[model samples]
Target: MAHLFKVDRVRLLCSCGVLKPITAIYFCRHCLKLRCGNCVSHEVDTLFCPNCLENMPSTEARLKKNRCANCFDCPSCCHTLSTRATSIQAPSPEDSNKTVARKVYYLACTSCRWTSRDVGLKDQTVATGGWSEQDNEHYKYLQSLLEHYRSVAQQEKLDRERKRFSHRKSAYLSLTDKYSLPSLLGRKSLTPLSPYAPKGDSSQSLDMTASEATAEVEGLPDEIFTEEVVLSSVTDMEQRMASPEWQPEKTSDLYPLHKHILVKRSLRCRHCEHNLSKPEYNPSSIKFKIQLGAFYHVPEVRMIRQVELKSEVETCVQVSLCNPTPHDMTLAFLPFVPEAYTAMQQKVEEPTDGGSLNTSSMVRVVDIPPEKTDLTPSADVALPQGQVILAARDDTAEYDDQDSISSYKDDPLVVAWRRANKVGINLLVTPKANVSRAKVGFVLRYDYTNTVATASESRTVTLNIPVMVDVGTVSE
Candidate 1:
């Protein structure tokens, strides 16, 4: 009589919608799918080293020579061998230190019965142990080698410094010329002065009177001094020479005024053959540091209903500006010129109250239909509009080494919105009169100087506003 046998089973649904019972199915942890070995392809499980297969602790496995100690295989037949321990006589106490003596174990396969004694084996001590003491000695040997190389490097550095100083001294002395003191004194004494005695008074006085008469005649003008003035005075002597037509001639006296002019010629470098004339002293053309800081008063955005649109739309945005500097500043709206517009048109006018003025004539304006005029209900209404996508923000404070004003133009936001969007949208600012309802964004940028140090700062502020448009029915 047999006891009751229970069968374990799993129900699986196939792709064809049929449910079937599965027996002896293997669970695949990798694929998370059950498989009958017949349904999937598989290779035979290969035997691995027992030390590698047993889930022993990692520290114990490292000490075992990375192999299974108990199992040995025949090199010829690949068969497992059995271990056989044999006890041999230990050495006497007097000779124990002289010879390393130990009892050993040997292995042999049952099929071949290959005994260790046949191989001339003996018992020996095994280091079945703690931390190996050999590592300390090896570390000390490496440290000594490192010190030897370090000393050689220091000696080379000193020798290089001495060679550099000697070369500089030799070059300096070769460029200068020096003379002895005795040769210099002999050259100074060679110059002589006149040693003629004065003549008798009457002869001296006659010589002085004749010299005075010659000096007086030389002081007269050329026209008064010449005597051969005649229209037909071209004798044979004058005919052979060029005619002295009264054209202005540059005299030698004028040459003294221009004697200081020095002519410079281009020179080339002897080694590199590069032209040395006007070589750039500062390799980078940057000259000055433009310190930029901005403090902006918050701008106000008001929704105003204009006279031409069909619905309540944003009309005008007002921005107030104050120049907190001692001197007046001319703020330049470089890329924010009013002629650049998307949809609506605009015109700028000066405020008659003398508060702030827009001198430009190109402010944009949107036309509003005259029917729906009320914007009183929706003051803070969320307008279904997409936000203006700005480029990455880069604060100028992070760039301390940039010393030129032109570098500010390369700022991420400035290059993306101002420069790249040049043809897409119109830029408007405050103090612009007759602004339209369709244009949405306005930015104000200016430079201001501090009152104390006169250090100037730059600021840019943007405003997003709503414009009111006239819809045909006031209720809708």
Candidate 2:
């Protein structure tokens, strides 16, 4: 209870060897192991603009430097800039005699009340595109650099392809390029290089001027030491760092920045390759496409109440256990001891680079460390020693007055309270002596039924889970 701010007392140890809350962990149905954020792999599902909520393709987002086209952020405040419209009366082009009213737009910040006019930016006749955009001064040189690198990469790829192709006997020169009608009809001819084959771009080179580093450094201003520093007139670090390409040092040079693109990612289990969490592609839709959270799959355990815990002394601790599954469960409690991470502490997923390591060498190599669970128990728990039967979940049973009361008889020492699929149980916790705050742990062995259709036999599988509870020091 009241564990929002402080949850170290009730952290659960994941398979990866990490201690975390159940809400932060995931249960892979295939592996049946607790996965924390560290052990899962994150794959970007969609790129979107957080400001405009517009979905963008990966290629388009890359081309735009992963920034939104329509949305802009205030340079001064770093807040989203809103388009403020003002009505202006102007002479109509078609009817010169008549004065027509039209709306003009300018970027403004609601938080700081900074407007485009403050920075000497002109109001636009049209809202979006009429705003002035700063082009990179070395645009041509940058394009040439890109072309030069692309050609070099292409040539390297071509060389690698040729080397690979020369060794293969299945690959043959194109018939159209090597053989002519005359050769097919009578005369034999030597094969020429195929026209479709990649050739080196001899003309591709950098178009910019070359310069080497010199001993001389650029001189600072003559009045640098004497000049007065005005904080309001200078841009903050955030404003300058907002646009990395042009880090404006002064407020006068500050410009509206394009909003950076946001991405939705899907998490997958590393062991079984099962999707743990997947979000919908639509930016506006908040619902998830597939979310297999540990909270929904595993039995949630929470500390309800605990008696005084003296060092090497017997104490009573009350905890509420809820079965998230829809089927009836035969629950058992157990102690969990946390150990060091061989593969980072459980809950953390191993990162994959989308490539397999070459294992054909003299020694087989693998990146991830082995899993280690050889941890000493911090505390001990006294269990019911037998199976605790819990009935299947009934949604309507909560509202029914007749069914609201539990008919199942419970042992006085074990079951403190029971409602629906949730049961409150009391267990004796004994902590090690001299340890100020010893964490008591238990191993819960339960009978779980595998309902997956691919399973050969739908039978009750015994599952053992380790749980830990924090017990503070008790006075003599």
Candidate 3:
């Protein structure tokens, strides 16, 4: 009996405009055509490892050169190595000896003369269509560990919250006692004056009687004022205590009445064991001042600015080290101007510096040692108008070579051009190894003088550069 497969659709058209079925036909993605394998031109496909064939997805297969993605060849010689599996056999009772069984595949690359012995095979299973046995015990253990950690974290969070609430409540009570008690006591007198007080004459009569009794007690002196008199004197004290003026010192005055008070404390870093602050107090004023000494090195370079009419032009650029450091630091400038360094060096060597330079003549080099004094400038350099100039040197001076004219190099015209065009000059502030922190000030100034009769303008533009320091490494 013969089995037949039906073509669901005709995907290609013949030259005669007749549609053709695509079943058992090869498809050409480039030509957008379908043809039987017999009618189409055939190419040999690459052979791949069987293990790779069972794994890697179709998208990954294309990226991995259509070969087995899981397999790798020897770097010394192109060779596919085999993975071996070994199993120990059980010992028989009569012989009291055991044997072993091993399985391995020999892998070799046809194009390369390389070979290796069978090493080992990874333990993996080729599953038939069925559900795997559930590992309930392992899952339960993981769940228990997760619950334990979560519960511990939640308890710690609750403890922190409780502490915060208690601190807030205590602060609230203290503030209320300080600001509210005086007003509450002052309002107590207003209640008795409220049209109540026994309607005028009765309250007046009670006050007159109290005054006469106080006068009579004052008149009786010495012998009559004995222990019984003292006891009687203390008995009426409770009546006087309720009066606002007779109460103990008001809570409002508990805090110091003075606006400014000196506070003294010592502070230290727990990690580095460094004294961040010392016991220093200013008695005249309540302010505390902290002094930190930071050392910074400013390494800058100056370059001649030249604007060219043509797309390709060479401009002379110079880098110098201004060693602000107490000790000498190494510096160098590397030009990334394509091929401009040769021209810069040639211009430096030439005796005459006669051309009017523009901003385009300046090129910035980045990430070079600040100590390097010698630099060979480029020849013909190509630059786009809006291109960025990133220049760096080992140090912070525009001119380091003693042979060069220092006075002329410090000219505002040169300095302004370099500042406006150079990239790495003020890119970042970097602290030296021994320094704690640095206060860096960067100033870019330019003087423009217009000799034209119609108009004249001169101004300076400044920019602050960020500083970055490299800290020492720490091990995990």
Compare candidates 2 and 3 on TM-score and give the better one.
2
* Candidate 1 ranges beyond 4 A from true positions: 1-24, 27-34, 37-54, 57-66, 95-102, 120-122, 125-476
Candidate 2 off by > 4 Å: 4-9, 91-100, 137-224, 305-313, 337-384, 400-403, 433-436, 470-476
Give the alpha carbon lDDT tens digit for every residue of 62-97 in model 3.
344344433544322324333333343545546667
Best by TM-score: 2
Computed on alpha carbons, the lDDT of every model, listed in order, comes to 0.27, 0.69, 0.27
> Candidate 1 — what's its lDDT?
0.27
lDDT for each residue of candidate 2 in 75-111, tens digit (9 for 90 to 100): 8888999999998898998999999998999999999
Best of the two (1, 2) by lDDT: 2
Query: Residue 414 of candidate 1: its Cα lDDT?
Result: 20
Which predicted model would earn the best lDDT? 2
Ranking by lDDT: 2, 3, 1
Look at candidate 3 and tell me the lDDT of residue 223. Answer: 60
